[model samples]
Target: MFEIERRLYDEGHRFVACIDEVGRGCLFGDVVACAIILPQRYTIDGVRDSKKLSPSKREKLNGYILHDSIAVGLGRITPAVIDRVNIKEATRLAMKQALDNLTDKDGKRIIPSYVLIDAERIQTDIPQLGVIDGDNIVHGISAASIVAKVFRDSLCISWDKAYSGYDIAGNKGYGTAKHIQALLEIGPAELHRKSFISKIMEGKK
Candidate 1:
């Protein structure tokens, strides 16, 4: 994983942003994306795909990534936006927003000379490469994944307070069996993606 990023560094790309997203498969809430730029050749131990890590582990890694990263930015697209533009475009939009948010403490924009995205081609003037399963194998993408996962999970926890039965916090908005049962019993909440639940509702009726 480090070797891939190291090669990019050797090629003179000083700032290489590794991008990844979370909640794309969720039945509620927003899709979140994160862009993380690490110092050249910097490697953090035990960093891997957020999906493979426990919640506690991811929370801890999130702190380390934020502290050690050269630049980190996050983006989120609401359920409304996802329904309006569709999930794929919404995801790309979030990625662009993440890139746009990259800046230093002085507020000067820190644009990446190169971008490494996880299996998604984004429209950007800056050069970018899309690698399949990059989050599992690429250190920087894994870091970004952890940030996105942890941030989105935190939001779900807050939402769970208002919307109790769906277990939004536990399932993180994924359409688990428990979540689907709640949706059937109570119909969709304001936060639920209507389009996503429509088919399930149809089946019930």
Candidate 2:
């Protein structure tokens, strides 16, 4: 909630909420999104992009957000859906799912008075602004980023045990050069986003 008032002015809206997603690049995990609205006076010390925080810090914020937020909702799009709709659309859908789950003080669903996002704009009825680095710039976006990232990353790490060959724990399923090489060596495991990786190699034909 700190440093977020500027969003009210610069975005030309008095009340702004933020939305963000994580795990787009992971080969073995669900994509997660979080939509968060915080009280104007709310403050969480050391809050930043989830990528910048340690696992413990992110976990702590996860609890803090659950306890302290004005409104918070999480949504996840599964790997099958990601493969079917592709990553970008699935990410937006997940964001909308998170948004749909949120409510204002009156116990009724309300569009964010204004919304800020880290990347592409979603064609929703709500008034929204897209900021390239929004997660770091907007506190609510940053908080959502933190929550979504921690949640998704934890799932990836847990999945590493279930699907061992791709080194999911180290790469988090991104199609790194090594990951691709491994895929070629062993062929895709059930965990790989076969469509995305397969596109690069044309189903390895």
Please tell me which predicted candidate would have the highest lDDT against the true structure.
1
> Cα RMSD for candidate 2?
3.4
Per-prediction count of colliding residue pairs?
Answer: 0, 0
Give the Å shift of residue 19 in candidate 2.
0.6
| Model 1 superposed RMSD (Cα) | 1.1
In candidate 1, what are the lDDT values of residues 13-82, reduced to their tens digit? Answer: 9999999999999999999999989999898888999999999999998999898888888899999999
Candidate 1 ranges beyond 4 A from true positions:
none
TM-score (C-alpha, index-matched) for candidate 1 = 0.96
How high is the CA lDDT of each candidate model?
Answer: 0.91, 0.78
Q: Cα lDDT of model 2 overall? A: 0.78
TM-score for all models, in order of appearance: 0.96, 0.80
Clash pairs, candidate 1, are none
Superposed Cα deviation of residue 20, candidate 2 (Å): 0.8
In the order shown, what is each candidate's alpha-carbon RMSD? 1.1, 3.4
lDDT of 2 by residue, 118-162 (tens): 786776888787877877777888898987887777777888888
